[model samples]
Target: MIVRPLALCLTLLLAGAAAAGDIRIKDLVEFDGVRGNDLVGYGLVVGLNGTGDGLRNSPFTEEIMANILERLGVNVSGEQFRPRNVAAVLVTASLPPFARTGSRIDVTVSAIGDAKSLLGGTLVMTPLNAADGQIYAVAQGAVIAGGASAEGDGARVVQGVPTAGAIPAGAWVEREIAFDFAAMQQLRLALRSPDFTTAERIERAVNRAFGRSVARMEDAGTVVLDIAATGARSPAHALSRVENITVEPQRKARVVVDQRAGTIVMGADVRISRVAVSQGNLTLRIDERPLAVQPNPFSPGETVVVPRTDARLEEETGTGLAELAGGTSLSEVVAGLNALGVSPRDMIDILKSIKAAGALHAEFIVR
Candidate 1:
């Protein structure tokens, strides 16, 4: 079991070994302003092999097609329009941290109209927008669909999502977010898990790096630090130097159990108080039998029907209450429940009952 792997974990915890406390600095904290920007755009997909949206149902698809034709000097308004080669779609992508103009990024395209499929389609150039309604990037490339579809007159088969696809490095950045990460005088480290003990550990670890107090805990969740005090020329260089320090973390005790699936999850810090538990199951079944009276042959007599029912109730009892001492080990908890001759499914019910009786000290979560 995965839990047994941690059984030997106590040796490392009890030995007070400094090597066991090592952790990646990236896993501990987040830089204050290093983030990504979201970009989205409206676009048209072409060369769909006659599996595109219906022109009548999605008028926007036809309008977009007409506009594209007009841009290319192909007049279509004077003629009847029936196109099976285009689909209306929305393109979305994320601009990475420190993205520069002309830098390419991946994009996801999903059909917004009643497009039957987007397979073998090519995207038209579309301008992506930020929350401020400003164009930030433009996307245009051959679609790499992750799905396929086939349809006949009366039957159709589809595997995977044929209406959505992805384009790798399909969008070029048209703008750059203005932020100078290397020139900051003060930088903040945000703890992923905000505990006072963990924050103090980080502060001490960073201060020990410079042989002076360069970091301080601002609150339970944040640690503020002076960049120049570390004697580094740039914030980038200082952060690159500080983010590798490792520290031991403090976690809360918790136990989570799923009722429908008969699954249990326990944290390493979870503990249980001494308690007694007994469990059993009772079942009842009912059955019905129909009785009928038959009329005499060639006689004008009415037929009558009668009903009967039988019921049985069976009770399954346990041996007796199993007692556990205070601060009993998890192995002991397993042993006591095993004595009742109940499997994990039954043991889940028993645990719920024990927790409800205030005997189980660990937090009980039901899903």
Candidate 2:
């Protein structure tokens, strides 16, 4: 019943009159030289309720603790300390483009040692460095863990991940990336999905908006824009204007199937040639019945056991040799498939067979 309902919905979707609309240029492409940088730092999280790393098992945790105490002007050079309320963690954050000093960003804290949990811990002031080995931000705040855990003598229950957490707006930016966006003579737009037709459409749309040939398609994946031709005050102004232009993007026909969930998704342009399909199920039955023989009282000597088995093969009569004509539209294709009266899982197998026979004409993806 569920399969039939799903098929009906898909048929209706194909038969609908609605069509895909145009998309803004900003949503379709990424601007060159405008991206984020990854920043990471090793730090310590404290104030856990006996759920931190064991000092005996994690020597690095003890070493970092000693360093932190030394930095705070506390002399613990020779004294031994064992603390169950601290954990070693790695703090990570992304420095967003155009981020300036004093701006705060979010950071993720993950336990790097054998810590039980990071539920109620507070991250120490940790300096986050970028790929260039320069400090860009400092993170320090109370962690908001996404999950929780509890343990008894013999059992433990954990829901979600208990050792990883995040701090919102917890890192303060200290350095700025030196990128002169205003002085750039040109900018490039990189398509998220490379297509020659989409790239050409974007080029034409941009030039039409300015009434001049300002943007040119460099390749299927890139479009180069001449900022001077737009006559904007700066490169930023030129980009701001170009990013608002809308264009319809073209995509390839594709079919994706998830065998585990018995689901299939097809693009509107997917088509199938004339084909014949037959489906049936064959099942084997096996049964075992062991018999026991016993001696009569005051009569025979010993008891005997015997075994017996019955096995047979059965095949159910199914839809035989269904012919599907070549479909001119998506609705016809789906209608023909549904006419076989098969479930989605069975339809997936049929599609695979059709593709093997060179009848299905779309990119097939199985997951």
Q: What's the TM-score of every candidate structure?
A: 0.82, 0.89
Error of 2 at 85 (Å): 2.0
Clash pairs detected, candidate 2 = none
Question: What's the lDDT of the predicted structure labeled candidate 1?
Answer: 0.79
**Model 1 clash pairs?**
none
* Candidate 2, 23-77: lDDT as tens digits: 9999999999999999999999999999999999998999999999999999889
Number of clashing pairs per prediction, in order: 0, 0
Winning candidate number (TM-score) = 2
Whole-model Cα lDDT of every candidate shown, in order: 0.79, 0.89
How many steric clashes does model 1 contain?
Answer: 0
Off by over 4 Å in 1: 1-21, 150-155, 258-262, 284-293, 301-313, 324-351, 358-367
Output the TM-score of candidate 2: 0.89
